[model samples]
Target: MATRSAPPSDNLLARIALRFTAFTERWLPDAFGFVLVGTVIVLLLGLATGQSPTALIDGWGKGVWSLVTFTLQMAMIIIGGYALATARPVARVIAWLATIPRTPRAAITFTAAASMITSYLNWAFSLIFAAILAKEIARLVRGVDYRALGAMAFLGLGTVWAQGLSGSAALQVASAESSPKAVQEVIKAGRGTGLIPLTETIFLWQGIVATLIVFVVAVVTAALIAPSGERAKTAADLGIELKPLISPLEAEPKGRPGDWLERSPVFSVLIFAIGAWYLVRHFVNATGSPLNALDLNTINLILLLLALILHWRPHRLVTAVREGAPAAAGVLLQFPLYGGIFGMIAFTGLSATIAGWLVDISNPVLYPALIAIYSCVLGVFVPSGGSKWVIEAPYVLDAANQLQVHQGWMVVVYDLGEASANLLQPFWMLPTLAVLGLKARDIMGYTFAMFLVCFPTVLIVVTLFARTLSFP
Candidate 1:
């Protein structure tokens, strides 16, 4: 007969991570204030690095508006994704999945698995779907822990999104149309480096393996730290009650011809038909080709078209937008402030200085790890992957060229690092926490558990796999 060993403790690393999470909760302000702090930090760095006050201030002013087009794209992605999640069919699916768990351990584990898979489809959908699903499961399964389940939902974004179809940095670098002008220009400057195809990044074996590892680790961690019995909080205990945000039934307007048009499915179906045609033609044209057109634009267009088709009625789409708009408010409010920080970093040459320091320390073998670590730190201050890539891609790509590193692996490393930092950074949690009616502190503990469990996995996988791809 064998005796089972004692269950593992949270470990020193996990304890430290939890302590850091607690410290930040007490001291760190909301996402808006976080960006404001970032702006100040960037400004001070600019001044300290010998930039004139006039130039620094002017850079911030111009930078704040530099991302107008990109901002619109991001906004559409969020709202469109939310609209897709709000569809009755999607809600029904989530509700069905919520009933599949029989125990608290099974509930948390299943939530983590489902959330990670959904995140790999689209981060926005993952956020809304997982939050609602967790709540639904908690309501259905007595003694389920809302805090653990909520953290699992949020953990998906921090874990698998970097390897996902809608991942911001990966999609941006994979196609010219999806990349910002700044990123494209930098790619142009890099020697023999042009658009990186997703086949080499997201579709690669390394990416697939790393993502699988992350999902497994996340689920296991959720199960390991989950509370039991009286410690568990049910849906009611957590005060999470979700109502239908978008109603399928539209109220008809009296005596107005346009009202009929607005409420009819015919026009919306026609519009979605056009979008469907574009998507089909896009893939058809690239059949059997190495070059493809799947990017952020494609992802957003598909999301929008799907939402329109699902909603059927034009007025329902409007209602869905109204429902989803609040979740995206934080993105709109904080993105421009980050745009300014981007300006300060890019225009003031701070990014170059940082990049140069890394290049000086990096050999071929060390480059991937160094890039990953650097991107993790950068992700904390600028959580927008597209925005962060716009600033970092130029120097990062240039260094990769010099070191003979594969651009695909370089992009992958950067993406993994950014996603890793999401464990510590709570910017993306604003919408998620709002929907779940939980505080950041409630979820951060489990998120940090995942971070401790998965960060080294990312570091090791990317570092080793990048070498193989680059050398081979």
Candidate 2:
């Protein structure tokens, strides 16, 4: 692997951050190992909650495979996204962005903005897009801090994804059919509010405003603390070499008909034609709304189609996908472990126990804030936004009704907290790190810095906006 340059002596904050980054690099385990440790911690928590070891083991066994579909979806997202990023047009765009950031300061800020905006469109897209963009920036910018730029790009997701179109919690609450069990229970209890429209949640003026604020603060934060001089990483520090996707071998003659087929665009174009039809059909079938059609599977299919169209040849797309697969292997290996942990939490009633305590201590005025805090804590363990909401929503909804707080406000609060807590969670960073050929340690310190800056910002934003919604 590549080595970073020495930390700068002049900037105290930069020096401290570099030291911290080095410390984490030296001490932190690989992403798979880190999640394995997290699984063990969750197992202990299950046992502490009076679950029998035998039952907990069984729950883990069952839970480990529960996310099979989701795992495939996530893996497709990474692999497909990476392939899409390698497309000629996409590479040109990245090259253009890379040239724009003439300095280290501009590099990180541009990365932050690009990541935030793209991630708002689709979280999966954000992962590979930002990493690829950062890689190009590192290649182009002379003094760019590679590690910092990588971390900042990754940080952009947690900073704004919860308020975006693909946000699991917001979308979940917006759809009655897919709403969490707790939300359903609230309806049965006569205390639950009806389905919240996306307009009232993710598309609300406050949420939009808050997301813009986060984007601005994140850019400013990047500007303030970006390492300079010796502290920054050159492209050489990456240790990995960058290559254009267009191979010279592709221009050489193919040996057989199958080889010719693979090199031809006909197959890919045909596939895209079918996929495009399906997508159009899907959206048309939706009752005059497309937001309901947005989800992991849909996004994955669309991305696959885009990649095929952009790459223009079956063989090239296949090669690009193969190259990208390893980056997603961490997710494949660890999500089952996470699934096991989820099983223990869900089966053993630990989620309810924790939520119950929060309800017990919460009052009307403090309910939203407390729930937001609770969501943040829970988010660390169950970083899957939709799943976390499933566990927290029932009790939180019941409690909110009793406290006379608006249920929509509760969803907003949970969304903010969940996204904020992901700042500290490394699970979501695996693909980006893998793509960048870096470890968690390289990015942890910077991401932690982002957390310090964003967590409070999110809390304050949620509180203020929630108050407005509740009062109105």
Candidate 3:
């Protein structure tokens, strides 16, 4: 890793953060273990809610397969994104970006901002994109703490991601077909429409403002507490080596016809040409902003096509993808466990019961705050913004109608809380952890700091600015 010397000192806050890191390093289990325990917790919660053991078991079994498609999509982003980044041209761009930040604090600020801005486009893509950026920044910037960089790479998911274009609730309610029937009814009653448009949800000026405030708060906090000097644990200090990606698909001067094909660009160009046409069509027929047109498959298609063009050979891209597969293993194993947890909460009526109690105590003034907290808390268990939002929209939007609050604002509120919990959840941290070759404990301290700064920033932004996106 290149260094301009060492990162400057901020031992005061660094010392405090180190204490938390130490505790987590000592006690926090592997993320897979965390999910297993969460499964147990959800099981217990279901049983305590008077659900039959048979019912809970059935839900658990059934729920395990519910997120299978989503799991594959997440896995693709990791593998495909890594392949794209390791391409020579993309690596060069990243290398140039790394040189831009001369100091550790500036590096962290840039990373956090990059993560948030890209996440605003698409959270899944942002995870792998920012993770790659953070690693490159850590490589070029001396004295930058790897843990802080890793956390900043992940800050996108927990901070402003759910408030952006790909946010599940916003997009779900933006279309009547995608919206749950209950939520559709709520929207009709509240807005005199069958769906809540993104114009009224994520695209609302207040949501945009709140997203910006969160971006600043998180970036500032990350820079302020970024470790330096003796407190810094750069990637080298942690014994992690940065290795350049190499392709095994190089041309063979004396080999068979298959070797020639492996090294040729014909297949890749053919595929890329097809994908490019589809991308143009996708955006041209897009419903909202072009940014909103970025769903998971669309993003993966773009990444795949870019990687194909960059590698310029079908087999070379295959090698890059194979190298990236291990990073997605965590998602493969843990998501099903979370799927079961989602099933337990949804089928056993645990979520509705908990939401019911919250509804009883909430009036309009406290409603947004309550929903934010509720979404954050629920997010830890479910960990899926899209599917979980489907489960939440009915009761959550229903309560908004009852309280006479702007129903669309509640989506923003729910998103705020949903994202806040990700800092502590460790679920979405898998991609960053894998890319950086670190454990969840290694980065949780910085993410915890992010939560402290971003969560309250979100709550206040929503409660005070409710009128800006006022309901009917």
Which candidate's lDDT is highest?
3
The best candidate by TM-score is: 3
Over the stretch 418-466, how does candidate 2's per-residue lDDT look in tens digits?
Answer: 8777777687888888888887878887777777777788777777776
Worst 10 residues of 2 by lDDT: 243-252
lDDT of 3 at 253: 70
- Pairs of residues at least 3 apart in sequence or in different chains that clash in candidate 1: none
Clashes of 1: 0
Q: Write the per-residue lDDT of candidate 3 for residues 4-35, one digit (tens) a residue.
A: 33334564556666666767778888898889
Off by over 4 Å in 2: 1-16, 180-182, 185-193, 244-254
Ranking by lDDT: 3, 2, 1
Cα deviation at 347, candidate 3, in Å, is 1.5
Q: What is the lDDT for 57 in model 2?
A: 87
Stronger candidate by TM-score (1 vs 2): 2
Model 2 alpha-carbon miss at residue 188, Å = 7.1
lDDT of 1 by residue, 1-472 (tens): 2322223543454344445545555676766776787788878877777778887787788888887776777677667877887788877777788889998888988988888888887776677778878877877787877877888878877888877877767767766566766666656665345566677778888888877877787777777766666545566776667554434554566747757887789999899889899888887875333234655577779888898989888788898899777766776777788778777766776677777788998888889889888888778766777778878887888787777887778877887888888887677776677567777676776687688778888888877887677521
What value of lDDT does candidate 2 attain over all alpha carbons?
Answer: 0.79
| lDDT agreement with native, every candidate | 0.75, 0.79, 0.84
